[model samples]
Target chain A: MTINAEDLHKVAHLARLSIEPEATERYTQALSSILSLVDEMQAVPTDGVQPMAHPMDATQRLRIDEVTETNQRETLQRLAPATEKGLYLVPRVVE
Target chain B: MQWEAVIGLEVHVQLATQSKIFSGSSIAFGAEPNTQANVIDLGMPGVLPVLNEKAVEMAIKFGLAVHAEIPERSVFERKNYFYPDLPKGYQTSQMAEPIVGLGYLDIPLEDGGIKRVRIHHAHLEEDAGKSLHEDFHGMTGVDLNRAGTPLLEIVSEPDMNSAREAVAYLKAIHAIVTYLGISDGNMAEGSLRCDANVSVRPKGQEKLGTRCEIKNVNSFRFVEKAINHEIQRQIELIEDGGRVIQQTRLYDPDLDETRAMRSKEEANDYRYFPCPDLLPVELDEAYIQHLKETLPELPEQKRQRFTEQLGLSAYDAGVLSSSRALAEYFDRVVELSGDAKLAANWVTGELSAQLNREGIEIEQAPVAPEQLAGLLKRLQDDTINGKAAKQVFAALWAGEGHTADEIIEAKGLKQVTDTGAIEAVIDEVLAANPAQVEQYRAAEPEKRGKMVGFFVGQVMKASKGTANPQAVNQLLAKKLEG
Candidate 1:
């Protein structure tokens, strides 16, 4: 994978970051260097090599399917930026 | 014009570990925002993530459940990105070397159809924080509470042909995850979320078309809508001689449309190198053997047992064994109820319906399995009629702790099983309806039924529905013959 100037801008935009104009070229070069290293792993020939997905060997942790939380509204509401009455308030969007 | 829709799902299941995958923070829900977050999750300087052993165990459990291969070693790579919700400005996840590989989920489609969607792989990843846009007028507030949550991103091969197939695949995966107890698989609480990778091919084509990934579809209904809408969009692009652009699109459930986030015409150079902070996770045979020993009876095996041993219908078994919790509930009810078929009926029919209607869960059900079994036994033994049984069931649902016998005694709900009492009532009805009796005895044999019904109703009224219908009908018929 190669990172061009346009690709850097798109990556930044998709990530919702405002990359400074000067930083875009710097990131493109850095990202390209990183991708080259990753591309090397592809050539290792994974023929008959199985991909690893998880580390643990355990399967199927059984839960009784019960509600474990309740009546902690006061505790949870403390994390909100703004609260009106019992509801969390945000900027209204639609009329 | 005939058209075929191709669909596949990318499910991110939050592993039900006691702590975050990388941090020591508790994975408890409904905690104060930022309270469950630790320095590692915040991605602060000088903080390093230590992988949770339980997460790896869960991933292996899932792999084993799906009959996938669990690699002896796997590596983690950094997914480079910058967002307010992403504390580290990068996500450490499995990319090239995922832990589980080459599993497939068998899905039952509509109309007795079956489709097996190949699973590409399931990788362990940490969840990012929630971005709450409502807090500010134009700014999105970031809550790191959900950040660092451990998730298993299960990606499926693009093999589905319709929305029904896609939903069925989602459901099947959901069942597997929940049954494994790796995830609660609750869409509303964000424990389980889906991203769909979809594309369309011409009626007959060897190669696949350009694919666009739809992001964070929160519900099963939304998955269906998002896939259908994306399919239409792709088909339109092809029909108009335009190409479908490969990009990440966000599904706006409120608008029922998918909007392009960005074009990924070229692949991302994530610069994904192995994390230097974390070593290659190596599992020894002894550890793997221990995890294997801890494995429970999986959903498929339980469903088979339900069918063969319990004599439950496939549909009934599927519904009961869909989640481990539901299966346990069925077992408990059977233990108490004594009749497997009746227990299956109550758990599937009444209990499930009530749970859905009341928006409660089986664990929170007011009627315990023992209580339900007791009520059913009363009905079976003719201790109470059906109507009284229903009344007792309502009392049970209301959390009345009275036993079935107590409820029956308190409400005078016992069936009038005394034949002598019922026979006396039948005689009185026969004397009162003499004309109808004569008509029944004369030329109209069919009119005899009406007379018998009249006598039975009188017996019921005299006994206040405590009289068993079978006993009443038998005594009335014998009196009519006389």
Candidate 2:
């Protein structure tokens, strides 16, 4: 559960975030604090306590397996920033 | 030396929610890069995370589908990471208290055996934005469109033995998710993805070997290939007296090999902690019971019913029940055709084959269930022969929505059931082919089949399949014998 400031800095760089150099120490402290809180769960003695995955015991509320949504080109296109003739245009994908 | 490959899958399915898991952003696909991204999705300051009730419902639906336990209280944990696509620099997911747990899915094996894959847990989480590396050159561009999309991380126990079981398990998860209307489960759209924790030990070994996690395997074929490649690599290392390192790896599908992404033993990138921004979501027992009541017949139950009630073969039942769309389609066909076995046959056989060939789905099929039933009824009633029905089926599949009777009537495809018309044609054929008839009488009796066949063809040409095949054969035989 121990994390180093240098490790935090490295992971930040690898993830391509523009983390300020001064923020690394702060992040290192905050992450350790959170992990320590997670560590507190070990003391709860989950020997017989079951791990939970969902909030309900219901199994598979399935649909009739049909496509309900279809042919909404105009509605979907409204969200696009740049579109021409039903094609989304980004900043020149190919040079 | 018998070596068993023990495999397990950790599949991540994006839940079908109207909004982002922790935000109100629209959960729409193929939208512009940042249009759907909201303040919470963008990880903007002071934007508190709000759990989408629909996402929770979907997780409950999935839990119920697998017969898993749903916890009354679950906490969202911040998986601390720095990824450009992860706008918050930490993913909000269930870590300690997941939503579902201790489930098992019974998968029917190819060899008439059954394997029960123990479900570890399925937790709800938010999706990260996409990295558009392919679109951008040199540097990867981030699209926050998918950020905050709800996802359910379904982890399975290491009970799988081979690549086949793993694929089956993945497919089962896919069907469950799609059936529950949880997510489209489209891997190509990144709605469904799999990360595998693969390891190798000698066959029947008690100790689990050093494991490596393979990330973001999108396709089922890739999951099998990546696991096989990784398994071979691990086995080779163990054989050579080398230790398999615990780390995260990436499957280079182009090279068909797995390369190390990071050393997990050294640094687990995820430093998980309960998120203070979101409180524990507690569901009451009554609500949970109501959800249970609403769950439809699961894939296994439907498959069993198709086999027992519909009298379909296990294979056909499995195919039909594989997806909600397919099963419903089959049911509609049966309702229309009023023949369960025949409906199962046409839906699984001809309809499925056509859909696969066109890379479409049952929902997208041009031929409606009523149209298919109508066509089959035509064949049943001798209004059109089987050969002519195929042509009608093809035309109907190509957007021609004419009824079977109408198509047969329009194309003059009716089977010739009239004996008088067929007899006239048979007489003309016998008169025109006296040489062949004489030769047939003079030659061996076997040669008579050829003469009769010629007469039958002439009758068919004259009557244009309107002549009943039984009638044609009977009339030809009587004349030839005389």
The C-alpha interface RMSD of every prediction is 9.2, 9.9
Q: Which 10 consecutive positions of candidate 2 chain B have the poorest summed lDDT? A: B131-140
Q: DockQ for each candidate?
A: 0.09, 0.07
Off by over 4 Å in 1: A1-95, B108-115, B135-138, B201-210, B232-243, B262-267, B428-462, B477-482
Give the alpha carbon lDDT tens digit for every residue of B208-258 in model 2. 888888886889899999999988999888888899888889998999999
- List the TM values for chain B, per candidate: 0.88, 0.90
TM-score of 1: 0.79
- Cα lDDT tens digits, model 1, B1-482, are 44566667889999898878777777788876566666677676887677787788899989888878788778888887656677687899988889888888776555544577899899998998866666455545556667888899998888898877888788888988887778888899998899888888877776788888999798889999999999999999888889987788999988999999865443375667666667677767787778778888877787789989999987888788777878888898788777889889878987798899999878788887778888889988889987678778888887665678878888788998889877887888788888877777784777676656666777677777788889888887878877
lDDT of 1 at A29: 90
Q: Output the lDDT of residue B32, model 1.
A: 63
